[model samples]
Target: MGISEMRRTGEGIDERSNFIMYHKGEVAGHRGVGFLVKLNLKSQITGFEGISDRIAAIHIHLPNHSKNWTVIQVYSPTEQATRTDIDNFYNNLTEITEKYSENNLVIMGDFNAQVGARAPGEEQIIGKYGSGKRSENGKKLVTFLLENNLTILNSVFRKKPKSKWTWLSPDGKTRNEIDYILTNKVKEFSDTGIIQNLNFNTNHRMVRSCLCESGTKKPRPKAIQMNKTQISNEIWNPITAPEDLMTVATSDIDLKEKYNKIENKLKEQTRTDITKSQQTYLSEETIKLIEDRKNLITKKDKKENQKEISNLSKQIREKIRKDRIIKRNKTLENYISKTGGTKKALKELREQGKEWITKLKDKNRPTISRNKIQNIATDYYRSIYKEQNPNQTKTQLPAKQQNIYNINKIEDIPEILESEVEKSIKSQKMEKAPGPDKITNELIRGFQVNGQNRT
Candidate 1:
């Protein structure tokens, strides 16, 4: 549930560790507003802002929904409060609402006001079900609602006077319906009412609403589990063995032939092992339960059907979670076996190094299709290298300049020493990009020459 008038500071709050809060000022902790999202729902929060101590908003991307939802929880000042405070609250609320105009908007909280029984002209904004008389604050709220095109959901829903009243006086003689749930999309909220039984040691009762969202549930993507250890054992070990290396080294085969032979063997082994390991993780029972839940929703059995769907959804999620955990453990085990128990340290280093490179590449890439990007790159390079004067006569260098360039004859140049060549190859950075032959400096250093590794 979203909260308002929290009266807390945001200093030292661990935003990364769930229970996110956004407060207006650090020094003035008298009144603040923030969202209290459940652990499951926390992942769906796309954006949030604390407009002021009186207003706070959060944007959430709901599952199976096309559009995001922006829920703004406010703590409007009472009628006796300063006019400046009230004006500031409304201004902040307007700015937040306008910013999230595209999203499905829900603004709810203790407004400290009542719309009373709907007047003739106010029928579009409020219904005839509101309790008590309208105060000066209530009039301001009504005008704000009209300006923003929002419907007061609490006023619109018909209920008993006792159920309609959200707040009670300390003396137990006075009661009012100041708390409300308002929305820009009136049709989305099919039902709204006050829940009086659940007490939170507060004067305000909970306001409940039934929102009918439109979306279709999409199936989760299938996971492909490959046994890397099996592939390494059956393919890589033999290909990299000393005997195989000696055979390849002694043979008169071209380098391309040697590379193709190794590549083909590795590919064949990988396919065979991966095909054997591949299996559907989601069960038929889970799929059937999902379909049943969808059928119940389509039939519009809101109460019991929704409860059953919620339970089924939890079960499906749990099953998926367990399957993924098992797959991850299996993959980790395979990696450990392949690396001979050095997987932990090596994996951590490799992941940390690759993360920056991956992020940089993703940031540089345009948000266009692969074909479009390729075409653009090709066009750019072609234009850059295009000859400006193809028909112009070429100029020849002067005889003295040509003679200077040919000072170092092929016979006059000294042959490079083996020690110097080895030192140069070893000094070359291993992280540098591969050359035209697609061979790395490290790979060159690893090659055996004269019955010894180059480096």
Candidate 2:
């Protein structure tokens, strides 16, 4: 069997019941539920000959075609007929009978075992022992009927003396009465009141209770209330009759289709519009904002670069001092090697090397005071240079050897000279264009006079 069919029947039923409850709520609770059923289905088999298989368990669906139901089919696969299955069927019958005030417990389907045989002392009787056939499977079914107190309605239908056989074998010769409908719960109906439908081509005939209407017409279950406002807006309320049920059920299918189509169209439109929006260029105001942000970033980057340059310069000076100390060590080693490796000669050499060592030590003493003035001068030059030419680079600066570089107050020089520089640039741009004026003047200063004298 496929996995779908292999799933536990109880779990499938529970999930289906939950789904129904989610969709159908406001129809008066489980109390007023009823069944609308079509049954005895075989593979693709239609009409009266709906039963084709040798044997499988039967199921009775509940009212309004929901998931919860009682089992009503007979002659399940032998392996499938466990105690649990039988007990579940009996429990559901009791549950349904108690669930609603109205008598809606319908036990209709083929039950393969006959309750009693015609001959007395040969088969099991209604009350007597050994009166029925002693088949092992048949005994279980008999016990189920007796224990549940279900009444066999077929016995009442026999009062009219209808055709005796309820099922036929394929061979046509071996026929046994097996199919039956039983119920002890519903009142106002008996075995004699049951109606057996025409043969309908299947082995078992369709049997229905006379107590049941030909067919019931009732309101469809209302969908769950999503919200009071939305539900009220979406559904016309106060549905009172079967006509209203049909009207509501029929419109939902069309509305659902319309809603799906509209959703698809909206998705397509969004995709198209998104592409156009991406290709559209930015407006001028947005461009200016971006440029301003870039400028701020540029200024920050310049400040950081200058700081790094100052650090690099300091590191270079420290490296120079370390190199001088290494050179001094090498000199001392040379002087010791030349002193003939004797202690007395070495002492004399050391005395002579004292002044050299002092000079080397002075050179490596980490000259903070001297370098501080140089650093201040460097800072002043950099500040004035950056102020005077905000956009200038070292490679782009003018090479003129100006005296301002030697001045201690170089920081104030930019403010003093900036206006004069600006005026000079403007004055040069404002000078008149260098084109010669034509004045309709003096014809073009031809070699010959206007009187037409020939040269």
Candidate 3:
């Protein structure tokens, strides 16, 4: 779908290790708000919405947890913004947060304001360890927090005054705790502070919050799973990027660079344009049982709840095992239903067909290197062509045939018209499998243009 005509504002930014940018202006500008889920935790995301350029929300539904989480990432307007704009930002945010009141709520990112300390009425909203003098915007944020049952996590944790600030002024003389992580799960919070060791290029020091139940331990940060070669070849597509990334017709970049930019943009389009929902094997009853067991485990009276918990755990385990068997049966049934795909699926399971071979062999060559694998097929084709043209030579070709084989300039090629694009899409086989970009013929054919918008 074309983003140019998308709604300007109202929900929250969608989440993925692959990101969802909420662009505000019609033009490609620098300002926007977004968030990225961890690669391992991407499946936990239930939904997300890009309401406005300033605010967005992502929901996470983790099995066994008492409640799902709705994390709202916001970039509040600067102090220079009009009073009306500022009020609207807070009002809209409150509306969205309230909409997901059932979920364990988390509001994070740059508030662009400071909450000095706990006032008489804000005892539950903030802690005694608040950073500095609260500004006007800060008061607004605190009021929003108070009304919404959000506790400023950073305020609750003990840290030196110098260590609490997240953003530093350009002159290096001013530091403020403008950024914050506010959540209702204050009891589960382990720690909160500024992280300066990270390699981010920004004026703000990262604010991190570690949260867990009473007896739960903090998990180590997950390392991105990839080998040295993959890491070395990786491109810097940072998850935090929130700007329009459309390709520009500029001479500064080479054709390869331009091509890569366009390909990357298309890939992002394909990712966001499609619907992605996580599939769960366990049934609702089993999930509820697991959640009940978790809640029991967190109770104060362990002995009283222990027997019930054990029974619940056993039932959960049994249910999970049964679900596994059912899933396997269903998978097999699906494979059997697909006439040609069954063989392909079985081949994949056995790792016997079209598997990447590290080495190639030829009778004459004996053994071939990775780079020489292409030669095996090329040689076979070469021999067949050679056999067919035993009496022929390149110099024996006609003048017209030789001229047709000559290299031509890119500029000399006819430009593809809009009509050609429409025709090409319409001509595709709808029954065929989707391409690498996941653009199936059915999906392309489903596209409709209404007024100025492409849908």
Candidate 4:
């Protein structure tokens, strides 16, 4: 409600508002209008429009409700402002109201104006509860209400004289109703009044209203319940299918066929495990409640639904946490059983590190593109392996020293044992980076399963 000013575009200001409106494809950080909706009501918002710094709106549509509701919040200039500024405010307001005339509209904000007591010809729009005498800005506001077929909700509901005024003067002598809530459909609102007890560090008291949409039935969606016992059994039960060793030993069949048989079993087991984990962690009843809450439109309904959903969500999260801990412990037990001890496990981990580069580019060096890094590595390695002149003008060694160094080369470096190769292949880690041949360690290990070794 302070002096409104347009923010400079493209300033890269932080978006701190609960819900901010900006020009299409641009950011203006200046005086902006935003809606501070409750967490449960956030999902029901369909879209928003930012007309200017002083005006912005959000559209809400609930499931099973055919009509859309548009709530526009505005902050008008004070009465002491120039005439041109006042005219512009009304002009923008008129355009916005007409554009959404077909939909249910609720316009509420500090207009910096008043309607005073009910006038002779303004009986339909203003009620008897208005405070203080009329001012120049007050008259303009009443005219705007009459033109748009809107009624001031604050004035319609009767309240005590002290509770009727929304704004208090600095000296505590003057009080007036400068803020208001206006609606085209007045029957939807059950009551409206100033909340006297709430402590807001401002001269204006907070105004609240109750709105009820009559004849609207609250319907819940169908629930899909899963049995936790069944899920657990499916995940923990071992495969009992007999192995067809004769077919696997047939030389005519290829290695891919053998690999697929094992891969298919592993994939099926993984799928069953995932399904079990999901069913155990998230209950069907909780999911159904969340879906039902999403359809609620009114603030009161949404607030209540949010509390229920929050508790259910917390429980599901805790279940997931426990499942992860159990899985980790099971994996550790299997690793210990297979490797025999921690020393053997550590040795396997060290060999697995060979496929990845241990050193990275210097952090002090300027950042380079992926292509540039590849190019530099290729050029450096190419230079290292380049042929050089053997008889170049370099110093020659002594004959005795040369003869001593040129000892007879062994005709055969003993052939690497099959057992050693198998041990190395088994030690390779799964899902590690591939080598120059574009083959992962897991793939190399897979080849050795049928006594078939890859280079």
Cα miss at 180, model 4 (Å)?
0.4
Better of 1 and 3 by lDDT: 1
Give the clashing residue pairs of candidate 2, or none: 34-63, 35-63, 58-73, 123-131, 123-132, 124-131, 124-132, 156-191, 156-192
Task: Give the 10-residue window scoring lowest on summed lDDT in candidate 3.
Answer: 238-247
Give me the overall lDDT of model 1: 0.67
Off by over 4 Å in 4: 1-31, 63-65, 216-455
Q: Could you give the C-alpha RMSD of every candidate to the true structure, in order shown?
A: 14.7, 43.7, 25.4, 17.8
Residue lDDT tens for model 2, 85-119: 55654455444334432333335454456555433
Q: Indicate the TM-score of model 3.
A: 0.45
Clashes of each: 0, 9, 10, 0
Give all candidates' CA lDDT scores: 0.67, 0.37, 0.64, 0.62
Candidate 2 segments exceeding 4 Å error = 1-75, 78-104, 117-135, 160-162, 190-200, 212-455
Q: Pick the candidate with the highest lDDT.
A: 1
lDDT per residue for candidate 3 within 268-364, as digits (tens), equals 4444434222257788888899778767755655446646766786888899889877766666677777653565444433422222232346776
Tell me the RMSD of model 1 versus the true structure.
14.7
Candidates in order, TM-scores: namely 0.47, 0.27, 0.45, 0.45
Sorted on TM-score, highest at the top, how do the candidates line up? 1, 3, 4, 2
